[model samples]
Target: LFQKESHIPLPPKKDYDKVRAAIEDALDKDDYDDGSYGPVLVRLAWHASGSYDKASNTGGSNGATMRFDPERKFGANAGLEVARDLLEPIKKKFDWITYADLWTLAGAVAIEAMGGPTIPWRPGRSDKLENEGCPPDGRLPDGDKGAPHLRDIFYRMGFNDQEIVALSGAHALGRCHADRSGWINPWTNAPTTFSNAYFTELRDNKWTKKKWSGPPQYEDPTGTLMMLPTDMVLIWDKKFKPYVMKYAQDEESFFKDFAAAFSRLLELGVPFDEPGKPAPA
Candidate 1:
């Protein structure tokens, strides 16, 4: 019989705070690629939370099942274990918190460490039982497709055109891997540092088709960086081009919109307390 103790012994909130600090510190460690692990962490959070399907109301950040076997093997999940393994020490230190919360918080922390906004977060998500989790393989967006494909994937998760564009802004921080996604190079010169370069490059660069045997993509004239066809679709399509252009022109605007959209992405399908908590003030 389950019973609440009169003097309930809960773990100190400072322990959680300390765990968060440890993660923040780890963000600065130099063992990883590009001299920082921030991009992979952002990718980890997106892969974890991007599985939501509004119609079935199943498979989002609430479960955190990617820690397990089958979900970890997902095709879209390729290379993400790098991020998960990086956070293992922090996870062991704060085993009281769920993986769902830890992964998302790591992303929030990584953003701040890279000079981005502080994402507001709470700790109520509980780990799901194995049977209660595991999203299908194709839930994530494919970089090869265009605006219609982006709409199909994101709309399945109940996001609008603006939200889809805003969320794609996260590409600013990470590169496509040749081995993983068949595309390569950071989207911006400062991929490790958060900024609006992804948008700027989209607008300013003369992107010719990458002359590679790998899947079709674009590269700048200097041929140092790469962009997926999906990224170009933002400008190719009429509906999404304006926001793309704005972000290209204004870094602060992109950061503000990205923070709002990403905050919403993390909270998708998460139930809120009464008087829904505001993002960190």
Candidate 2:
């Protein structure tokens, strides 16, 4: 007889909800970034899942590979340690839940709490042995590049043009730390909340080149905000522009698509176990 495919099962439904509430409670604090841990948590989930290379099926959130060496040291993952460490206490509390599931659930919870879309996430990812399945680096998108690079990076993960545009809307939440991405800018004034403000601002505002020494980022005439070249491509590329315009004009559409893409992101790899074995335990 042929052997069955291996996979971790999902946790019990109630247990999954409890883990989510715990993550939200731990992050809903006064002392965290943007008055909440929402943004970093989103980044944590993204970095974990974004390593996916669909052709090989080797990288993604399912392995929680960022917890190990080399993968953790990747330039793209530079500041994510803060996010990982912040969740340590919660991990200690719910020791049974895999880091893979924890990080993704945290992302979903953060989105909902920050007034973003309801990201439909399930908890079934199991942590791999240390150094067992860390993917090759350079999988994440570069902040300085334009449309072609964005397409190269995202399309490798199997995202279509619309999904890529929708995912980029996540820029609405966090600021780029100069120490990390070298482009210091927040996509929106309310970097704490999630909204279609990024698409709207790009559509309505005149983004002038900021006289900055670091890199060629665009600043609005208001002189209070900025956009990276990567952000600009959303409007410049004919393929991506339609989605940006659609999102800018319709927040409902952005929310719906973003939620679908995000859920898909967290489940990039791993075979689900029979019955409910993949649910959070």
Candidate 3:
């Protein structure tokens, strides 16, 4: 008699650690931008989860829908293919884990591996079958916009101003590739290392609009560092300024707040079971 065998998934923590290691291994590259893909990985995690709308609760990390059409092709998600492709092998290696969990966990792992805070992450996200789960194109923040725009975007996701400021600290990690975002330059000197340097740079730099053919962006005197309108608005806005100053002065506070907010960000719209319910397969 021939009988089919069913597959069993490993314990969440055990497999999560494996996936984390795989992502960490995939991070460093001698030839990649800033010698690591950590930035883009973090961006992937952000875009994956940032689509959540607190009211409708339609789009978020729950489905890992960015893998499909229209959403993957969105301008805001531009260049994220690098991040998705980087994780593809990891997905194959840990086939039992869902894309939603893998993408969010990779973001957390990449942040920690890059010398940032330890963001608490959990499993249970399932992949959406297709693009129907994709969020609308304009959901993500526009780099060219200012303070009000930043609030509208983050507030829609149920994030308060403090959390918005905290999450913005992630700007420390990656550069804007012209081919992708139509903007160029790193936000900090050590783009691969996550730190409060982003805040410090915003506080210290004497920024002037860059004279370039590309979209408007701010630059320091040496022309080495850059800031998008959204990044600059953190300091410009009265409400966001205190948090910015707090993070710039105290790395510990920044790390703590960032970890909490980022962890929350990843968990948005995910419908985890009730406490007593059986764990998700």
Candidate 4:
């Protein structure tokens, strides 16, 4: 129920903080398919926000339009309802926050819970009408594609080479589902923890093209771990490989850069802070 205020009043920022803490608590308790809720929460935020197009400004984290049937029905959004459902209690408790802000904050919470850096977040997004919902499918990157494809997809979202590498560090948390993306196995051994194992595995292990009937993906020589084609192309391609090697060589540096880039990814289109406000540390 909407409360009719005498005049437009700003919601307490503490309410957003409370919702964030509650979501963190929920993530701590949930041990889902990928071990922690961290991955799904990350995926939820990605799928929810990855729809942005700087050219048209049709979609972004702004509307939280994934709530509508048309947007929810997209194939890439499969299994994301699990994430939305997990955060429902938090939303109910913090009735003042919009679904857009709540979902992105849940991502920040998940990242922090998994031992990642704080994702600077701010509030002020509202849910849009269903008529303003639904982005065309395939906004998110495909695992089947190579570096060129990765560049094409993410560059369209306004990310550069460094940001793409940093954001893909999310592979450190979740596994590919055969049912969802036709890919399997977490890219790193400790899929739930927010370590730099993804870069480590990429550098240390020997990868071979997977010989399977599903989507095109790579396997480590031991044949246990997996890497998507797009992931491997980071090494195969000359342009992106340098950053990948840098992250692979230094864990601390990787974490620091990843935290900044991931936080920016979460804040993609939502305007927060004044024009001259200092950026998040």
Best by lDDT: 3
lDDT of candidates 1 onward, in order: 0.81, 0.87, 0.91, 0.80
- Considering only N, C-alpha and C atoms within 3 Å, which residue pairs clash in candidate 4? none
Sort every candidate by lDDT, greatest first. 3, 2, 1, 4
Model 3 TM-score, all chains together: 0.93
Q: Write the per-residue lDDT of candidate 2 for residues 1-281, one digit (tens) a residue.
A: 22343455555344777777888887767776568788989999999999998998879899798999999999999899988998889888888888998998899999999998888777678889984869988999887888999999999999999999999999888888888777776889999899999999889899877886887899888777888888999999999999999999999999999999988888887666654244434
**Residue-wise C-alpha lDDT for candidate 1, range 1-281, written one tens digit per residue:** 24667467875563557767888788766666678888899889888889988998887888888988788998788899889999998888877777888998888888888888767666556688887758777888888887888999999988887777777777778687777766788888888888878888898989999886888899998888888889999989999999898888888888788887777677777665532664221
* Alpha carbon lDDT at 64, candidate 2: 91
* TM-score, prediction 4: 0.90
TM agreement with the true structure for every prediction = 0.92, 0.91, 0.93, 0.90
Candidate 2 or 4, higher lDDT? 2
Q: For model 3, what is the error of residue 109's alpha carbon versus the real structure, in angstroms, after optimal superposition?
A: 0.4
Better of 1 and 4 by TM-score: 1
Report the poorest 10 consecutive residues by lDDT, candidate 1. Answer: 272-281
Clashing pairs in 3: none
Q: After superposition, how far is residue 227 of candidate 2 from its true place, in Å?
A: 1.1
| Model 4, residue 115: C-alpha shift (Å) | 0.8
Q: Tell me the number of clashing residue pairs for each predicted model.
A: 0, 9, 0, 0
Candidate number that wins on lDDT, 1 or 2: 2
Worst-scoring 10-residue span by lDDT in model 2: 1-10
The candidate that achieves the highest TM-score relative to the unseen native structure:
3
